[model samples]
Target: MAMHPLSDTDIGDIHSQLRELRTEHHDLDLVIAHLIDNPPPDELLIRRLKKRKLLLKDRIFLLEQMLVPDIPA
Candidate 1:
């Protein structure tokens, strides 16, 4: 799909959001690893973190999809 016309500021904002999402995903990975290493982990916390990670993944996918150029077939 062709990307909508985004102002410089809009592009900047999307980049910033993408960065934050990646950082958050990395942090979640650490949390998941720590939980796995420790027995009797907090199930609720792990569940919440996983949900947040999934949300970030979805957002990143959307942003990436927006960046893809539409090809004429």
Candidate 2:
């Protein structure tokens, strides 16, 4: 199956989503760090947060790739 190219609006929307995901990923990092600093942190919560952060990282990478044009050699 062939994929359609993104329009200007679609690209803009993707950029916006990328920014939000990056911000959330950074925020999660801070929260995880803080939680670790406190004694006897909730292991379950930390694990969940780590999982979410990983997912966001993946999404961010995908969006970034979409922004780049493919060149034929």
Candidate 3:
């Protein structure tokens, strides 16, 4: 997936988003770890964090898809 068509601003935006997503993922990891260590987690908080992690995963997937050009048959 070539990035030539993307303008500088577009590339910058994507980079920024990726960074933010990574940061969020890292934070979630810490939370999950803490829950593991402490035991007896709050169901609601766990569910919410898992949902957010999935959402971020989807966003990252879409961003990656944007880099790939569609092939015609």
TM-score preference between candidates 2 and 3, better one: 2
Q: For candidate 3, lDDT tens digit of each residue in 1-73?
A: 4345777798778878988998898899899778767868887888888899889889988886765665755
What is candidate 3's TM-score against the reference?
Answer: 0.78
Whole-model lDDT values for every prediction: 0.86, 0.93, 0.81
TM-scores of the models, in the order given: 0.81, 0.91, 0.78
**Order of the predicted models by lDDT, top scorer first:** 2, 1, 3
Positional deviation of residue 14's Cα in model 3 after best superposition, in angstroms: 0.5
Q: Write the per-residue lDDT of candidate 2 for residues 1-73, one digit (tens) a residue.
A: 2357889999999999999999999999999999999979989999999999999999999999888776655
lDDT: which is higher, 1 or 2? 2
Off by over 4 Å in 1: 1-3, 70-73
Model 1, 6-40: lDDT tens digits are 77787678888899999999999999989978988
**How well does model 2 score by local distance difference test?**
0.93
Give candidate 3 regions above 4 Å deviation: 1-4, 69-73
lDDT (C-alpha) at residue 23 in model 1: 95
Clashes of each: 0, 0, 0
Clashing pairs in 2: none
